[model samples]
Target: MQKSVVVLAVLAALAVLSSAARAATDAPAELDLLLRGGTVYTGDSNEPVVGDVGIVGDRIVFAGRKAPAQFSARRTIDATGMVVAPGFIDAHTHANADLHSTDPRKRLNIPFLTQGVTTAVIGNDGFGGFDIAAQTQRLRSAPVGTNVAMYVGFGPVRIDQLGEANRAPTPEQLDAMRQHVSRAMCDGALGLSTGLFYPPQNFSKTEEVIELAKVAARHGGLYDSHIRDESMYNIGLKGSIEEVIRIGHEARLPVHVAHIKALGVDVQGQSGDIIRRIEKERAAGLDITADHYPWTASSTRFSAALVPPWAVDGGREAMLKRFDDAAVQERLRTGMRENLRLRGGPETILFSAGSTKYVGKTLADVAKASSADPVDAAIAVLRDGDLMIASFNQSDEDVRAFMKRPWVMTSSDSSLGHPRAYGTFARKYDQYVVKEHTISLGQFIRSSSSLTADTLGLKQRGHLRPGYYADVVVFDPARYAAKATYTQPALLSEGVVTVLVNGRLAVDAGKPTGVGAGQPLLRTPKAGSCT
Candidate 1:
């Protein structure tokens, strides 16, 4: 009897031990995935550092300090020594071209993901191509490395309704344009963007823009503009700014200035005045916002650099005819000289998407070799291709000044144009935030993630909170840097190890896992934005 009692006591002790162990490691019921380790900047001022983030289905349920007791997940990621923040939000992009021209997801998204960007806003500078329904349909069907939002092309809308004439639309045409805008918004455009600096859009006046913006506003969308002037041209610097501010007031819609800049050494130190205008307006509750790339060089088409807008009035065929005309050619050269001065110098210019042979060469070199004037060299390149070039016109002082503002946010100003498109986020971290120490890690994270997501009204995103979307990035902060340059724009960024979009692993273990798990960010009626 004594021996039997001893064995029973031992067995009871064993059962108790097992029960205690289970209590300590019990799984939570709501989690499909769990991320544990390092530090999490939740973007929530309250509980920024959470030990574990619990995911249920697609959304996060718990993100505070905890171990799973009643819950179990199909997968758990050990994210020790990583900073999991919201995915970087690109404020402006031409990636819309990417979706239509090719399978958007099949390309090298590694450069973007490696820098922790999971969402890119496409359609800027007033141009998004035809066939909206088909494009959105493909975006939904195929899947992509990041969430993509689109904007309707104001330039195309103008062209489709009215040719490239320098006049306001007729009352009937205006109504038709409104209908087109309505259809585009219905077809899932987040807002409207106008490249007013370009030909067709430049022809439009401020009143017309206000009218178009009213259409966007009615559908709960914002108006974003590549302003009519970035230099001391016909409208002048102050005039261009007033245009946007006036639109905000006149149309009662949010206005976003796309790639805001005061181009040329002539206006180098005038950014402060622009900032003051924005601040004054913002304080008055005017919905105004802007974004800037970290680099000093601005990138765009070569045709824009050479030919006068008037000559390009009839589109490519007419423009080419004028290009062949000697008198028009003289006018083009004169315009190029004036424009080139606005763009710093030829050496500061770096060619991007063009004949690969001309990619890194400057206008000076190309001009010298071709035995032609630099302007003529640029025109020739454009004749062969609508080559994208990066003009280094921005000042370091101005960039730093812009960064100092709480209102100014970071942007790549990058399209699939070149290094900026791929290397923007990495460049921000490596060049400005870490290497230069211009901003803290928290500031950098906020600028790239939460601040950006908030601007777009991404509910429950851009934070490391429980019940938030599981869009996360893991990277070593110290080693992060951009590798791509004018010479090689396709080079992937370094230091990012893992990236998740809506609980799906688009990038994992420093490699793309072949997941197209991004979701469309629909426009909320009250919080309209540029897609």
Candidate 2:
């Protein structure tokens, strides 16, 4: 009896241990989502293959041919016949400026999301806000549909330190500007951006830009510029590119040209010249890259396109006063005539916004109707608030040449007047990749996603790999294309059936899910750097 009792107790203990082991083995891996049977574009690789991607919380937990056997997901998607890729990162945008709109639709950024863009780098062309911390925090205050990153603008910083003054900064003022740049870098600015093509920043000489860029360089940040001129505005096309190269050489930081293009009648076929200079500098081990919109036409304010930089020296109020000054009117007219000629004439400058009567009319048409010179008509239009223009001045050959270059990535340079604001990525894919065959599919994916992320130093959100942020896009290859035009700038794109920002669904089944999962992307300063 004693022997039997001991055997029974041993069996009971064995049973208890077996139950505990089973319980531990059966515990769920708890993945948030799983995407199966999609042709994945890994972004880094040149070819895509069938694969599965798994997400847990805000990170991609698995991305390979085989799914994790242990994990049980709350949501599973059959992405068969779709292209699963990293969501696009727009390298240049003004989206951050519109985040404060009371309209929820604008804040949702559906135009961006539907095109498969997951993030936008704002404050381009030296118009980024002054307080980096405040702007970043404001994004958090009211969540946006797309992730936001910023560059501290030289224009705003210069204007803030010295109010639209048309001269070089004094030593004391230079110190103050440096302090501002440093503060912005500390507050998570990616780098310094200059709109040297615009006022205030236009007043700053190349040496001044180099000095400001050095502050960003110390923090391991980039130097991005709408160069001193894309055409014959001030320094001319080749000279502007040389200035950028000089800045990169002197500052010892990566220099990115915002909206790389050969604009106007004088610079029509100069894309090759620009490319050669960049390639030569790159071979010398200086980092230089550029972003280009797919469109041949460029968009901006009419004042920016037609008005002489000297006339806008003291800001809008001063500009209006100059318009009225009888003494300066003739000079202004002469300057405007020259500027108009550079922009491929008034017929190329189509008004897109600010006046209903002229919305779809070219400056030539408006000028004809008013029975006035196109230059005077342009100046008159500027008097009635800011006018947005679509200047169709570039050559298809120039655009294609630039697009074929590897260093040139895709960007929107998006704003209110242009269809590019709503359709850049989709248009690039549809026209360049699918329709025109200007570049391969893999190259298109890289330019839109990983390359842009790499260029901007967005560390965790570019590739569809394990341990990266789960910002992903799944689109039907056959159905994806841009629908927005200059007139219908708000139309959403098709084909991006689903999008996730930080593992949360922002778009589902080709519709917005009303989840604002985007967060501010701050730069990770390289080791031994100030940021």
Candidate that scores best on lDDT: 2
**Model 1 TM:** 0.89
What TM-score would every model get versus the actual structure?
0.89, 0.93
lDDT of candidate 2 over 1-531, digit per residue (tens) = 653343344334334545446345544455678888899998879699898888877777667565635456789999999999998999999887566567766777778899999998998999887599998877888878999899999988898878997988899999898988988888889999999988878998888888889999999999999988999988899999999999999999999998889899999999888888899999989999999999988998888888898999999999999999999988999988998999889889988877886898999998999999887788788888778889998999999898888888889998877899888989998998999998988898898898889888998778997668889999999989999887787777898988999888999999999888888998866566652
The local distance difference test score of each candidate is: 0.74, 0.86
RMSD for each of the candidates? 8.0, 7.7
| 1-531: candidate 1 lDDT, tens digit per residue | 653343344334334555466467543344456777756776655234746776655555556456446656678888777776767778777665454446555533555677788877777788864345666777777667778777777888898878987778999988888777776776667778889989888888888878888888887777888888887655866688899999988888888888788787678888889889889999999988887787777887877755667877877888788778887667777887777777776766677776787877888888889898777777787777777887788788787777766656667766544788778888887888777888767777777777766766667778766556778877777677888886777888888877888877777778888777776675655434323
Please give the distance, in angstroms, between residue 81's alpha carbon in candidate 1 and its true position after superposition.
2.0
Segments of candidate 1 deviating more than 4 angstroms: 1-27, 46-50, 64-72, 101-108, 129-132, 326-330, 526-531
Deviation (Å) of 313 in candidate 1: 0.8
What total of clashing residue pairs does each candidate reach? Answer: 11, 0
